[model samples]
Target: MLNLSDIFAPSNQISNIEVNKESAKINHSLNVNVSVDCVVIGFDDKELNVLLIKRLQAGDEKAYSPYKLPGSPIYMDESLDDAAKRVLVDCTGLKYVSLEQFRAYGEIDRLRRAEDVQWLERTHGLASTPERIVSISYIAFVRQKKFRQLTETYQATWMPVSKLDDIDLAFDHRQIITDAIRKIRRDVEVQPSIVFEILPRKFTMLQLRAVYETIHGEKLDIRNFHKKMTNLKYIVQLDELEKDVPHRAAHLYKFDRVVYKRLRGSI
Candidate 1:
């Protein structure tokens, strides 16, 4: 739906990044066909958000509006895990993000679309785009407020998951996001501690319940939720209260990882 030529062009910043990549190489560098894509999920009180990127400008070309998950071709010198981390930092300007590899996406017709193929050819300057690209995907659910420093070679934006219908994403990124959400749901079921990864260090009980309700897509009974939370020995109540809020301050609670691990060991 967007012009490919307009969306991608030779840029100064990219050349800088290339220099950094080359600095590590002593000889001619060879790259594998694998690429790394990251799905960074964040939670607001009411809904979930996803970190997406789009071209900053098309220069003279007509800029497109569609976005893509932050990713890039992996370096031969780096492991997949290291590639995920490096690509995230290079593409998204996120200094740190702890990612877990969840899936590998490589369809026979992965680069069948004209826009996608053109994107590959333009950005990577491939004379002939590869027929297939194996995407090693990584995911992370982290506190949004903690990582506000996000910018891609293009630009990064946090869009809500519920409103994803509003814009377009390149390639099979939509499917990738769905898979990440599905995995998060399954992992939360097996280990409730996974939910804490998305939350702040100190949180309110209502805020905790909100995260649960948003993930499950249903309202929870407040009484039952509170009662069950009381049994979480690792959820330590604190004297601290939420500051500068419109409503009454609620006492905060912190997760005790040591207690949680010890309890898990005993059980």
Candidate 2:
């Protein structure tokens, strides 16, 4: 008959070794590949727009024709946020801008074509397999004037969001852009900072109302709009009025810092 100690010793040692091996494998698999794409949005002349760049490549006749969102794979030593900023600067010459993470896509077989696989392999030397892409989409709000100046040299252009539905965007970017716009609109209802991106530094109450109406795609009552503005106290009178206009002059207002802080918390 075997002793109780001898019987338990081998089983306990084997279980400990197996647990350690499993832990190492779990740690290795946790190191996932991540990529970042930026959906840069700007508002110009009462129209909401997104920035797109034409891809440049050799042996591709239509390389500079179709536009796509600026994107690149994350480096081994870099974070996703850093990779996004690098792509924006490399493609659009914009830097130090604020970006919000909108979504993460990790569906297997997201890339469908052999050319797509080849392109990734050539550009980043990444093994193009159908394992998992796992992209992080970011949204950036930049002033229209700054955006234009920075992206003037590249084949980058500001496209109206309303016209996005009919066009075909590279990658799964159309879906990303649509989601960013929806999130922006929803943020506008809660956060006053959203208006700062769309409105001029100094604007009239009527102009502010117009911006809200345009975003919501609905008309708002002037009287009720005024009441909401007063209740929120997010804007301050600049003691100035609109100039060079044929119609009656409207009072110019600026965003109030204190009011913004108060409303920000509630939002």
Candidate 3:
């Protein structure tokens, strides 16, 4: 058994993580041909955030803050989707979240960082590493409210995508995040309901507008946005108002999934 005290620096920084006793064990029989990486982004009503794990360098506990996407080398008998789901469940205790397999990244220098490569080799106990490890990446955006507290058994935590430039990331994880953001931006354009996935069941028009503005990286005219929302019959207005907020409490609204499904079927 690996000594957690010596291998890990004592950290209280909680995310989808705590570097606790629940650290995963290596499956000696992993598929060397391909691995799966997952990028789960969340929206906190104001800023968009991405889930990231602190990857410690092998034999160097002092070098902390090397965050990376929560991922894994696929088990010998597991499907790519299964592996992606496993990564999320292991790292964040999240299940039943929708994830899209965006694209494959196979650049030869994708794992050029020595510490990153070392972490992988040691974590997985790979005596013989693969010459070329192609990554199958998946992406999703979840509601921030779902993860308000530090989960007990999970591995990374939410980091605002805007602050991504401020930290040290491992491997091509930064590029993966950039690509994931681009994919989601385009997805929301094609399907507006994707926005509701990260929003609370009850929300305000301003909250709705902010999600779009942040995702698209621009300011949307409020009047025009409200007008557009009025046309979207699936968005139902509720009698409740935002509670305890300092600002004027705006009327609450919720998405009608039944109506949305009906309308979407017609289209």
Candidate 4:
């Protein structure tokens, strides 16, 4: 468990504090409740995936496990960016993530789902809540190698993006993820893809193409892709090949981020 004293206040300062709700309201006049949600995407060899957490069903101990995106209400003094990072770390044991604010969801009943309302009430001791919840959603990409390290300390599991259609996610996360991926696709078209976030520092052209195809859900013509990549001039070929593959080894290449940023600016 996270120590609230360590995160919110020093023990010496808060040792005998007995601030009630009325006193807290008088001390800090802010009344809005906000949260941060993360759609953490990663790529492995063959597919694009999102990380989800397993939660116990409210009032049901032995029922099928319910899954949801990792998130939490923002702390009183936390920045939205820091709240996103804190939620990710508290839920998934992931830290130092590269997160971008992709969208804000503030529908009057974003928490209208029975499970959502019930879970919040049960977990947080809320009753007859009437205020709307505003969630600042963020998107982050993790390289497969880095993801492996995070999974060691987390119970979250990665599910393929393609399979989300059959999964029942809590809250409006399905829509959140849909919007996030749409933005990513648009960015991929014009900007240097942050897809490199899910790739290694060095990899083959085929590996690079695989990442794009998996996320875009389309097959790129091999000849056209190779031609376009070469023409881009930002992908640098390294004088190295795969070490132990049974098939013919493909030459390795790495994206020159400096060149990509420069070309993107000109475009």
Candidate 5:
């Protein structure tokens, strides 16, 4: 027969054990959780564009507000690149896009919420608090015509990249877009493959020059730009020319896949 004090003391010990277990969990959550977001860039009407989707709130079936970059949580089993591809395709009906992971944003308190603890609890269903969220951002170049707005619930639209500052976005998407734009500009200088994303299947040298100038935000010397392209030797002269132009018809050119692949490695 145990004394009352001993029985009560054991109950107290069990309570302490449970408390310790919970504390351990809270302490162990120091690692930042990973997520993925994509910056889908396209070129249309001689301007750079980005894909955006309006965010929807829980239980607000009819409430859609503020455009944001298409993104989602990374699954445990999927690779970051795979997760990005999945999210882009699932959200926008685009596939086989050339994507590159640009950077990770792991700033604490990046997410804004009305009720901090309650928001996490309701959204993620975590038993304890999450320490940090690290989002991996990717940039992909897609043709404007390739994307189809698949989900009506979340309105997806392509806005010109130059007008990004004019719109409001959720989370750190604005920063992500800025970074992606910088990356695109850098690639334009070194990798000629990026031109394929903006130019039509068959384009004139002047049109290609226009793409470079548009992305660089500066005018390129027509002769020098043409000379550089000729040196690269990847553009094939097509037996076609622009029609109904006020000026002389410029010779149209197509990107040679074999030469592009060889130059891709060099770039």
Candidate 6:
């Protein structure tokens, strides 16, 4: 019923409000409590180890006994992988390490335990501990040489995985490591490259067997182990022998990458 002039009048016009670009870009409902946890596995001197970092308390300069898995909250501008790599560098001073996501844990009580809350309070300076944490856990196999690059001190200790039960790890890390172990065990049976990471590029059969036994957590029959390895086409036995050793000079061997690629699909 209104006239065209009245409808188009400046007095009746609705103006568009100017919005602050930064304020308009904010996402309040986005999950910012997401974090990444790394279960770093390494082998040295015929023993398998897991990397655990000692977190210094925020208030007390002297309290630094409690060890926890290397982790950090995902940053606003970084991808999850970048956040994980940052955590790895922060903990081990190593970069470009291979990592694969193993699990995503989202529980209301993931960070609600009393010990977890206390540790978060003392170490992280969190005014209020997050009630729920959604963490993406990753597993990495660190070569012995790469592991040696880490400056081992009270701050960053490489404890034998077998002895993890004796040590009290912070947060739900113990369970996460347990899950990673199970996954690695399954992976090693299928992928020979995993075992290679724990040993030198050129290693004796005895050294290889020791690595396997350490990861398997049980003694393997030497004869059966040899027989199974001999049947594998990818394991190339070299004419080269050990040098400058206290023990006998055993023949060395290495896995052939070309053969492994061809056989990987079948395995």
Per-residue lDDT tens digits of candidate 2, residues 156-252? 7788888877665766777788888788789887776778666788988887887777677678999999988857667788778899999999888
Residues 94-129, model 4: lDDT tens digits:
777898998899998887776677665454444433
Per-model TM values vs. the true structure: 0.83, 0.75, 0.79, 0.81, 0.71, 0.81
Query: What is model 6's C-alpha RMSD?
Result: 11.0
Pitting candidate 2 against candidate 6, the one with the higher TM-score is 6
- Superposed model 3: Cα runs more than 4 Å off: 1-28, 62-65, 149-155, 257-267
- On lDDT, the candidate that comes out on top is 3
Candidate 2 RMSD to the real structure: 11.7
Error in Å for residue 66 of model 6: 0.4
Per-residue alpha-carbon lDDT of candidate 5 for residues 151-265, written as tens digits (9 for 90 to 100): 5545778888878777777677888888888888888768768787567888888888877877887889989989887677788887899889999998988888787787676
Error of 3 at 43 (Å): 1.3
Each model's lDDT: 0.77, 0.68, 0.77, 0.72, 0.69, 0.72
Per-model clash counts, in order, read 0, 0, 5, 0, 0, 0
Of the candidates numbered 2 and 6, which has the greater lDDT value?
6
The candidate with the higher lDDT, 3 or 5, is: 3
Which residue segments of model 2 deviate by more than 4 Å? 1-32, 62-65, 113-115, 125-130, 151-154, 219-227, 263-267
Residue 171's C-alpha lDDT in candidate 2? 68
Worst-scoring 10-residue span by lDDT in model 1: 7-16
Q: Which of the numbered candidates is closest to the native, going by highest TM-score? A: 1
Q: Please state the error at residue 208 of candidate 1 in Å.
A: 0.2
Alpha-carbon runs more than 4 Å astray in model 6: 1-32, 58-65, 151-154, 264-267
Residues 1-267, candidate 3: write the lDDT tens digits.
543222322221122322343543532245655888889888988989998876644467665346888887776446899889988788767777788898898999877666666666666655545656899999888887776654444346889998999998877888899999998899899888899988888999999999999999899999999999978999999989999999999999999988988988863
